[model samples]
Target chain A: MKIENIKKEFPIFNNKVQNNDLVYLDSANSSQKPLVVVDRIYDFYTKEFSNVGRSVHYLAVAATNLYENTRSAVQKYINAKHKNEIVFTKGATEAINLVANTFGQKYLKEGDEILLTELEHHSNYVPWHYLRKNKGIKINFAEIDEHGDISLEDIEKQITNRTKIIAITHLSNVTGAILPIKEITELAHSKGIPVLVDGCQSAPHMKMNMQDLDCDFYAISCHKMYGPTGLGVLYAKKKWLDDLPPYQGGGGMINEVKKDDISFGELPNKFEAGTMATAQVIAFNESINFLNKIGVENLVKHENDLLNYGEELLRKNNSVKLIGNPRKKGAVLSFTIDGIHPHDIATILDEDGVAIRAGHHCCQILHDKLGLTASARASLGVYNSKDDLDKLNESINNCKKIFNK
Target chain B: MNLKELYQEIILDHGKNPRNLGKFDNFNKDAKGHNPLCGDKVHLFLKLDENKKVNDISFEGEGCAISMASASIMTDLMKGKSEKDAKEIIEKFLDMIKEKDDIDTKLLEEDEKTKLMSLGGVKNYPMRVKCATLSWHALSSALEDFQKEVTTE
Candidate 1:
């Protein structure tokens, strides 16, 4: 993929921010919108805007076809066996919550273990905390080595026969470490426990095949993948999705309503409640096309090049401590200067027009494990170039000079 | 983009050679403040003279140069002033961070909001407002504890 041409696709890249060419290095947090995705959404509001699966009017028919059409497109994009197996939730958080509420309510009993790795994001961590507190389900961690690698050894150590489910992230948002999802999933499958892979970080830039991963549930956010915000896809095995109870109860999730005893609609319909983001969902098809046009493999290769270069620079600075040092990581590079706090690094870097994420990246538990409060993170996306990283490198170097040991 | 532009070299010097970095085992009052957001923390020790004047202030923490410099500055500002005026100065600093409308730092007769204009740069970036204010918050918390102990004892 041509990185410069891809930059042209994001108008935000064309405009100056803070009076400088916006060096947006914060894609792991949220991505800038491509012009095609933006225009698709705007055109829907201007031309064909209506509620999907409602009304017999032409606009409604067009909207319904467009909205549901994105489902098959996404199913094919993720390689799920059936379109009905895909449920559209608000975002990855909601997708996880849907499964948590339904599966936690039904399958998890007192003392049932839910396995998670130390590299899991807070979104993956908190919902299970709710389950553990409310349902008496036990939560256990698969150990992360000093380098932030999650091994099958720890998973096996933590998994007793009582282990009911294993929820893991496909990639670590902070360390950029890629989890062994296939091996992890296969391990869980051997014990007959379904695995839920949080693909919020991986689905955007990495190669994601629901079938090949063989995980029962894979959750993703649309905005993370160059689509609009407020939408995510939850891919589940057909039987598991069919067996799980309805998550949210409201309009459009019903087959028939009686005075008493209401029956719910089937599969994906039962999960999505109330009025959906019709235009964004319809616009999401354009995102599917966008991803298809610039293949996921090429996008990964392009981003990995940036990550590879950034890491080399990061390693040269002896004062900088790279958090979650691992054998395998994603495009995210998180570190902290020895004396300067992550907050200071973030502010100074922002002044230089280098927009990188600084904070715990919402993984507080990992920070606690590392014996630090928060670490600065520089995450890459499609449009980032060597120049963008050079800015980060320069700003960080200035910081090191000021706080020289 | 020199360090002196935002951070005076004096701040870095003070951070590198912090005055009150050592422990104060016995003190009139002590309090700890932790910024859960960035994980910066400070344990402040205050020694007051017989006339209710600050004899000295010292601290120990893991923080950025700005925060440590601000803490060192806070100690410098505290020793010469009485407890009452010291409290007022802290309030002024807090108001500066709040960055309320109609704040005039230059007009001394209008009140002591001028001390706050020193942090006007914080207005540019919303995230660092908390980082700038964390030291002030920790100082206020320490003072509040001191006040509570004085009333009871």
Candidate 2:
């Protein structure tokens, strides 16, 4: 499929938003779903609705196969060695919380450190903070450089003998800086420490290979991947999943339940407690197929072009300070106008049907480091185009005009 | 829903050069307000005299034009008012923003009423109503000697 035609695949663009075409630039927050993914959800609920991994009924068996098919697709898509390594959670927040809860239960101890970066979203940091409060674990941050990039050296410098695990973002949602995960994992492994990569910002934009990256644990947000809300994928090595205790205990995660004793199920089921997001899991197969049809390489090329164009255009505009001049950046463009607050800028931009995110973007630490209270971010997905960015620039100019800057 | 109404010139003026935009030296009462949604913050300081009159009032923080302007105008109008009257004005202002009813502006001068009315644009924008009300809530908390930090959740 042609990259320009990608917008046509998303049904949201077919309708007008407040009498204007939607110039969606908040994909890093959550991507707009394509028609295939949306229709798949409808078709599943309308025709073949049933709970998975539960019953012997016809719809139950069919739903079970469809649900597991998505698991296989995700396993192949990320190139994980084993399909059972993929466990679904509510969202990336839950996935990270699952790891923190299970890992803290078994390995982490008082005074043990978990190395993080300044660019981590609240989802990645807050889970580990719970360990700090409950398990008395200390958390250290690897500082970002002047360009907002966290280098391998930063990670190595923060590693201590007490450092048990290093959790980091593969791609920063705010600065668009892609961390050196493969190298970070290699370094962490040399010290006998595990690493968890928050792939919420990375999974949807780039190709991911769990085996190649060699990170012990990685969490992905399905909603950001244009799949659906209420679904997340946690890819852990088989060894860790087996060794770690079960996160939550309930139905479907049990092997044998007695009044006196209880045993747990195996692999993914051990982590997925209660009824799963059956329809969302089944529908997400179409999201993977949609990406496969267009191809990640083509999508990357198209987005890089848009990012570069946006960077150059905003750079030439006076009083607009673009954040993070990383050597390698993604399609995220975060900036602050000199005289206008980000909320004002966002409010003005919304009048033009330009949907961008303003504020900390859930990275309060990074915002403090950058000396900014808030920022305006224009992030791109496969469907974004240069025309959309042009409207964004125009709307920014209007915002400046309103502020009389 | 109109952007021009929300971003009126008076709001921009107040937001740019906010009045009493600093901490008080000997504030008898103070409280912090935070809007976690957008990371907007306001720290309100009050110096109430022995007669229960507001000898001085000030604030320090960062926010959007609507919020900063609201705080600036609020502090400016709150000076010299009794604590009871100040609380009443806050209640009236919050009521107006929530579109409950027209507040009794008899206690306020015509100029002060005009300045307060400039913030009425927030009534049209639901998401921004918190921005306009955050500092007022903080002021109320300060007057009542509430210990917890006020949050526009």
The number of the candidate with the highest lDDT is: 2
lDDT of 1 by residue, A1-405 (tens): 465688888888777777767888888889888888899999999999888897999999998999999999999999998999899988999989888889999999898999998888998989889998999998998877888778777688898899999999888998877888898888889989999999999998887788898999999989988889999889999998889999989999999999988999987789988999788888889888988888888888888888889888888877887777667778888898876778778776776778888778878877778887788999888888888888888888876665564
Candidate 2 lDDT over residue span A1-405, tens digit each: 888888999999999987889999999999999999999999999999998888999999999999999999999999999999999999999999999999999999999999999999999999999999998999999999999999999999999999999999999999999999999999899999999999999999998899999999999999999899999999999999999999999999999999999999998899999999988998899999999999999988999999999999999999999999887899799999986889888888988999999989999999999999899999999999999999999988887777888
What value does the lDDT take at residue A262 in candidate 2? 98
Clashing pairs in 1: A176-A329, A176-A330, A177-A329
Model 1 DockQ class: medium
Q: List-wise, what DockQ does each model earn?
A: 0.51, 0.60
Q: RMSD for each model, in Å, please?
A: 3.5, 2.2
On the 0 to 100 scale, the lDDT of residue A180 in model 1 is 83
> Which candidate leads in DockQ?
2
DockQ of 1: 0.51
CAPRI rating of model 2: medium
lDDT for each residue of candidate 2 in B1-153, tens digit (9 for 90 to 100)? 366666856555785678999996999999999998767799999999999999999999887888888999999999999998998899888888889546675678877876777677668767788888999999999999999999997
Error of 2 at A39 (Å): 1.1
